[model samples]
Target: MVDDEDLIAERTPLPDAIGGRLREQLVFLAEVDKLKTVLRQSPLAAADRRENDAEHSWHLALMVSVLAEHSDEPIDVGRTVELVVLHDLVEIYAGDTPLYDDAGRESQQEREEAAADRLFGLLPADQAARFRGLWDEFESRGSPEARFAKAVDRVQPLLLNWLARGGTWRTPGVTADTVRARKAVIGEASTPLWTMVQELIGEGERRGWVSPGE
Candidate 1:
């Protein structure tokens, strides 16, 4: 009988045989398939299981398209969508670092930078540079699109937690104050969304879904 390793070897093309940009594109696509396996801390709204990076990225992309009007400034929706998707591709290698993990946050940038180099390097040079550029834009939050992308990234989990009745907010030491502090950047992208966030926090505290404060 053929063993699993042998089957995998048969399915994977020899590097020398991958002769063109299309081949490189195929290889990079295969590599990013691993993103589906990278689980995140937030639970799904419609499911009992936690979400994965691929799902989170897709969700953020859709949010950008649907909520572009809410942005504090006009944004390029297409560019914002690109930022959301490229932003988390690094997590395929670096893994999801929870927002409240102090120890994890300390090394998060270093780990993600390394992951970006290795992961994006799988693509052809031009494609790699394009992907890396968008990823950096998302990280730096320098442009209007980038800031709005960052805002939606934080908002997704907040919406999920509120909907899930204290999702990650139930983590030890998390309070309404903590959520507000971390998520305040959402205001930088959209004043209306920020107001909505405040309303949600008030409601969450009243319903005992989140702690009042420290």
Candidate 2:
């Protein structure tokens, strides 16, 4: 269990002239503010604008809280939320790679590893270690929390694309087979959620919002 006092301690404000661990924490916070400017390919459910990295992370965190019960394995909801929220912070520098971009994915891990070093290194030593651990765990998909967080991350964009009538799915190279291949990991975490994903994809295809499989 996480200590409530540790959470409080982490949140306590630092003085303006502080020049040690507190300064590092503040710098990390300021640096992460750029995540709000990194736009993703998916559009918002109710708006014309694309969702940004910060908003995408926030949404996934909330989804983890609300959808934890759907996980096939028991999970720590709070830890899952933390994983989801922190998973994409590296994208502020690495940029959001489109899900189906095979060329971009070839170098995505290398780019993100560099981004993680710079971004997480902005924190004090201990805090940087903890943040990197969370980020790495999410990337590895090794834990139940990581698996569920990843499932939600994938589902959120699928949901948005369905609602937005194909949204980015209408891009030239996107196809049903490619989407299914990319999203198959969701099934490993939650069959229920994966079922919903398939249903949405089927409906989108029927509506001409998603390209039919070849």
Candidate 3:
């Protein structure tokens, strides 16, 4: 075996700043482990249950295809698409908070904020801030782009629950009134989408595709 002095002479060292950034990147990678856990636990279909952040981003991008015609104003299709995709990147940290959980929302927000720092910190600075701004814009839901993105985000799950065999709401544990409350708000973004939601809820309920409590 080599002596201690010989081993020390051969050691490779990282510059301090470089090593620190590498540690930060590794921390960001840890969020992927949590995603594997979340996807396996289904709020929607087991097959459709994407890892929380992935699903949110996917459906929002899809909004452009599904929702373009219904926009009241001329939406910048490119900008709105970007908003949806970036909006939920923070779910990588905060986990998916179901919309109806009014009581737990405040607590969830705090956890999500912490998760944001660790997850976004992985990116080079400019990109991280750009994404963080998109997340903030989506949350505020004040602008035309933000409002549309929020609307589509809300619609994706509703459609998924209705479309998936035994969609989450179709089970006995959830209620029809819950459906009304949830989809009712979709009207804020698109009147046509809101109408489509009301009809689908009725069809699902009457056909016994959805259960009583649901």
Measured on C-alpha atoms, candidate 3 has an lDDT of 0.65
Ranking of all predicted structures according to lDDT, beginning with the best and ending with the worst: 1, 2, 3
Candidate 2 vs 3: which has more lDDT: 2
For all candidates, the clash counts are 0, 0, 2
Instruction: Tell me the TM-score of model 2.
Output: 0.91
Residue 143 in candidate 3, Cα distance off native in Å: 1.1
In candidate 1, where is summed lDDT lowest over 10 consecutive residues?
A: 1-10
User: Which rank order by TM-score, best down to worst?
Assistant: 1, 2, 3
Residue pairs with backbone atoms closer than 3 Å in model 2 (clashes)? none
C-alpha root-mean-square deviation, candidate 1: 4.1
Q: lDDT of each structure?
A: 0.88, 0.87, 0.65
Residue 203 deviation, candidate 1, in Å? 0.8
Superior by TM-score: candidate 1 or candidate 3: 1
Per-residue accuracy of model 3 over 15-68 as CA lDDT, tens digit each: 465645554444444434444344412245556444365665666698776677
My TM-score estimates for the predictions, one after another, are: 0.92, 0.91, 0.72
Ten contiguous residues minimizing lDDT sum, candidate 2: 1-10
lDDT, model 3, position 10? 27
Q: Which candidate ranks first by lDDT, i.e. highest? A: 1
